[model samples]
Target: MATIFKTDAGNYKALVRKSGWPTTTKTFRTSRDAKDWARRIEDEMVRGVYIQRSGAERMTLEMALKRYLTEISPTKKPTTQRAEATKAQQLISHLGKYSMAALSAELIASYRDKRLASVTSRGKTTSNNTVRLELALLSHLFTVAIQEWGLGLSFNPVLNIRKPSAGQGRDRRLSAEEERCLLKAVNDHSNPMLGWIVRIALETGMRSSEITSLRRHQVDMKKRVARLSDTKNDSARTVPLSKWATETFEAALNNPIRPIDCDLVFFGEPGKDGKRRAYNFNKTWGVLKKKLGMADLRFHDLRHEAVSRLVEGGLSDQEVSAISGHKSMQMLKRYTHLRAEDLVGKLDMLTREH
Candidate 1:
């Protein structure tokens, strides 16, 4: 039985047939629309096509997380699944008792205010961006559940939330003097690999992961090439080695640690595994740059420096892309920031044309 009523706000409503789940109700802008909704509800019940609505609408955030962990998280990769678990934990711990269906613009706004005001595990004040990322992560999980898991959620309240913009990208590069200083000052005690890492990074524009994971067998000293097997984006590329890079290979090979590990190129520590010892290089890099008062520089900027040099060496976009493994010209353009001073000869051609 369907009972029709008019709301105090003048919206028409209908109480559709009570099913096994909570009594299904339909609200409509018009009486005819309400009647149509009631008819559809009854038809779904009769046909046995109506699945039970998620108890999530009636349950807390914690309840949803427990369900996801036991029922779904097992199917994902370990790292990815762990990240999802962490996101769920954050939500459960913070908004544990909050019902998903009851989430509104104002409630989310209040949550953002609380998260931003709270201190993080790092004991630092939480920024708007941090809060925004957490909220966005939660929003994405809801989307995944509704779309991927067939949760049948009709509304996503997160759609109303605003995201904070990631601030300006760091434009860091080693100046000529700073580069010389870094090369000259590096020693075994103070990041012996930094000078070599810096140079190879500048020469090849290979990602840090690719360079750190390079093996002795992958290098062809005579051919001056290193074959990287399936790097980021599952890309297999051969980086042409410069003369300095070839010599660096020889030096590493001559060292007693080279071939004993079979294919491991850069060992983490003397006896440790090469694969496990892959360096992030930030700590040593920070100290070295601080010594020279160039603390603003980042180690990854070496790749940018390498690309800049490649552009200056008169390599076209295609040529540079092949060596550096850049997928598109637009990506390469970001690193090709040449100053007017560096374009002296090119500007002379413009004067001649004028």
Candidate 2:
């Protein structure tokens, strides 16, 4: 049964109640519109297809994203939380006005195309992986809204939309000559710690955050291992340190630039309130890359180089994965780029056996 009444604000409010269905309500400017909505809802209820979509219809994308940021993002890793927060902001800017119920597969596909064609402030086009990640965040939000938040969405719009192809993983390993030049440039840099950071990265296939956030207590110089309690995969891992890595930490310990306030292995200067923070060398890294004329190289590529070297040195996939902190074999394979020249000797041995 449905009931219609004129509100004090001169709008008609319709309320529908059924035995098994949740009570549904909607407000309309005219009595006819309210009655029409009630009839449609009643028909759907009788057909057993009625889903309470009032929450989705009433809540805009902006509101849902804001709620997700507050309620969900905080529970994620710091790096993931920061990245998702940025994605949420971008989503709010693009399609925030539409209510969740109004966001269809077509609308999501349109947003995807628009984002793919968009350029960043740095004058570079957005990568497919970046757009893919944004879409993933939106997909997760819809899933949460439907499952947990009682939004009553029949389907995730993002699921039906075509996502940008992530393409192949980067295989930008440093050449022997390029590596020498890069190391020389790093050594010439004003900050002595910068060179050691680069050296450690090449020696051990650790992510930038994992290397930077390393605590003094986590490193066991005698054992030549660094135990990370918090990794991107939320799994604690112990990475074996190379002789060069151990030496670099030893030098950093004696360096005056290393802060005293924090136990951070690579600590930065004190802030306005005298609180030490993690060392940030992004600017210096950029300058060094430009000076070396390797603008295409990323700091992360050093990890790729390390992984490739490990594979070339005949380390098993399992051994390399343990050192690199890669949780999945598929992910570890992406980082491993073997050189054709390095395979020639193995190919020759096979010929001899034949």
Candidate 3:
């Protein structure tokens, strides 16, 4: 049974009390609205399909995001934590005021459309990949709320909305001239760490973060291997060091200027917390690239170049994946952009042998 009462503010309040269900109440603007809500609750109770939605109605998106950042973000990698925090701010700016119960698929779809059409502070149009990552974070938040926090969401609205397409992977390959210029610039820089880092990336397909965050003990010069326990995909891998990579690592590890207190291979200046973190050469990298007239070249392209060279050197896919730490063959293929000029030499050798 349900009861409708008139509030002092001229609104109608509906309260439902069933034999086997918890008491629920809601306020509506009109008596008709209250009556309709009360009837629905009672019918659901009778059908044993009633869910207590008061928690969802009271909690706003901003509140949920705050909780998620505090509790969930810390469990992720440092790079992921920073990225998610940025994405959370964007989501909060647009839809934070809405309660979880009020977020419908249509509303989320509108957000998606608006984000797709928006521009960033850099005056560039937002990429589909960026929007997709933001939506993925939101979807995961909703899932966590329902499954872990016991929020009374019937279904994830984000799941019902269409995700933006994952845009094409970058196929930028470093040319021989560009590589020569880049190496000369890095080697001539005041810091030799930058040069060693660049050489290691070219010789081994290691990510910038992975290269910068390496500790002395993780590298074994005798075994010619670098053990990576903290990777992007949460999988541990041991990377075989090429002769060039091994020499670079040896130079970097034996750096006379290295601080005794710092365990990082590429140590930055002490932060405000008085702790040395991974080397942050983003600004330096940007300046160097602009100076060399290769302003569009990205550091990650060095890894791509290395991966492509490995394939061209006649390493099998399985062998390359082991060294590159790529879990998927498809993703590994994306990193390989073979140059026709380089392949011509191999073709001539094959013809001579035949």
Highest lDDT: give the candidate number: 3
Model 1 ranges with Cα > 4 A deviation: 1-55, 58-97, 104-136, 155-161, 187-191, 270-276, 279-281
lDDT by residue (tens digit), candidate 2, 1-354? 999999999999999999988898999999999999999999999999988888899999999999999999999988898999999888999999999999999988988899999999999988899899999999999999999999889999898978888799999989889999999988887878788789989999888888888888888888989899878888889988888889997887677766556688887778899888778999889977988889999999999999989989989988998888887899988999899988999999999999
Predicted structure with the largest TM-score when compared to the true one: 3
TM-score, every prediction: 0.69, 0.93, 0.95
Error of 3 at 98 (Å): 1.3
- Residue-level lDDT of model 1, residues 1-354, one tens digit each, is 678899988998888666564477756799999888777777777787764344446666677677777777787655556777776776777787887666676787778777767897879877766666678767875776677665556667778876655554445766788777777866444545656666688778877878888777888888899999847656788889888887776766566644465565655653444344554576777876788887767766878888888888898889888888878787777766665577998999899999
Instruction: In model 2, state the lDDT of residue 350.
Output: 100
Ordered list by TM-score, greatest first: 3, 2, 1
Model 1 worst lDDT window (10 residues): 270-279
Sort every candidate by lDDT, greatest first: 3, 2, 1
| Better by lDDT, candidate 3 or 2 | 3
Q: Please give, for residues 203-268, the per-residue lDDT of candidate 3 as tens digits.
A: 999999889989999999999999998888888999999999999999999999899988889999
**In model 1, what are the clashing residue pairs, if there are any?**
none
Q: What are the lDDT figures for the candidates, one per model?
A: 0.72, 0.90, 0.93
Clashes of each: 0, 0, 0
